[model samples]
Target: METIVPNWPAPARVRALSTTRDGGLSQGAFAGLNLGAHVGDEAALVEANRGLLQQAAGIPGRLNWLNQVHGIAVHPVSNEYDGAPEADAACAHEAGLACIVMTADCLPVLLCDRAGTLVAAAHAGWRGLQNGVLEASIKAMGCKPAEILAWLGPAIGPSAFEVGGEVRDAFLAEQAEAVAAFIPSANEGKWLADIYQLARLRLARAGVSAVYGGEHCTFSDRERFYSYRRDGQTGRMASLIWLAE
Candidate 1:
């Protein structure tokens, strides 16, 4: 299966990869490498796709999946963990344990320290982003925000992510800097919100300056990515990070 390795300067020992919506057995709306199991894709098909991805990435252990409540909850991965936990972000201090986040259009952020000692994955879907998901992740990593490196995975680009007044207000009310990421759209009372820029802005506010890989447009890239906004019943992609043994 095709994958997008994060383009940040993270240490070589910290391996991270984001899977695209290509090369899988899923058919119809969930076509091509759909990794998310909760999106109505067949459980067997998603398991098979996960197998393919793990083998492709040479992941040594099970990937930690989150229920993704779109909140600021961050969990630490442990061997006792069974299935998906109710959290929006996960961090791994142990090597070979993959911290994963599944998304269609919502932002999947991967973060790691320069020393490759800690890694985290966050699912930021505007609400979570505004509610301090990234900041929570950085804090959970137990490292200074400035010492962490962040990479933005595929998401609905600004041109495609139209939002109502409530969405804009949710962010602007907390962060005045977020106003720069919104622009007036053709529809009255709606604005085109740049999820990437907004995420970068939040990271910046948290003192994370080493951000990269925000150019992907899930809405526009039909072949390589899945867009929930473009297809209401589409599948989801996975962005994962882990430290090497």
Candidate 2:
């Protein structure tokens, strides 16, 4: 199982990895390490792929997965939680418990304090991004935003993420600087939005300056990623972060 580890300068005890669409029991549209349970793949196959992930990646303990709704809700995670909460972001201060988010095209932002005592993961689609999911995650960390380091995981990149004028207008309503992130697409009344740049702008406003890992283009990379825009019915990859026990 090939996993993309964040290349930032995190502390020794802090670990983060983004899974790809590779190395699993799933076949066809959901082939290769599909860890998401809600994407219509067979339950047993998803479970088996998760097992492969745990074994191959050596995750410290159980992952605290979220039932993401593409909203700005952020939850604190622990082993005692009953089930995945209805949230788009999760954080963990306790060791041995990972905070995870599943995504095919939506952006996953993984955060950790310099001390390695806190870790968080956020699922940010354009709506969540505009509505403050990353900000909510920074607030949940209980640390100064400047002290947090973020790694922007794989998502649909700028060139392929076409949107209507309303989508661009929504971001502009929040921050005028957002205009730079949108470029006129060939189609009239449409624009290609740069999800990575938009994320950076939001993080910058929230005071998270040390950001990394936003080079991936899920829509373009069919072999390594699962892009919902590229494949209507597809699997989901997981981006996870945790403090070592």
- Tens digits of per-residue lDDT for model 2 on 153-181? 99999999999999999999999999999
**Residue-wise lDDT of candidate 1 within 1-245, one digit each (tens)?**
88898878899899998899889899999999998888898999999999999899998887677888889999899877898889999999998988999999999999999888999999999999999999999999999888899999999999999999999999988889999999999999999999999999899989999999999999999999998899899999999999888
TM-score of candidate 1 versus the correct structure, residues matched by position: 0.98
Query: How many residue pairs clash in each candidate at the backbone level?
Result: 0, 0
* TM match of model 2 to true structure: 0.98
Report lDDT per candidate: 0.92, 0.92
The C-alpha RMSD in Å for every predicted model, in order, reads: 0.9, 0.9
Backbone-clash count (model 2): 0
After superposition, the stretches of candidate 2 with alpha carbons farther than 4 Å from their true spots are none
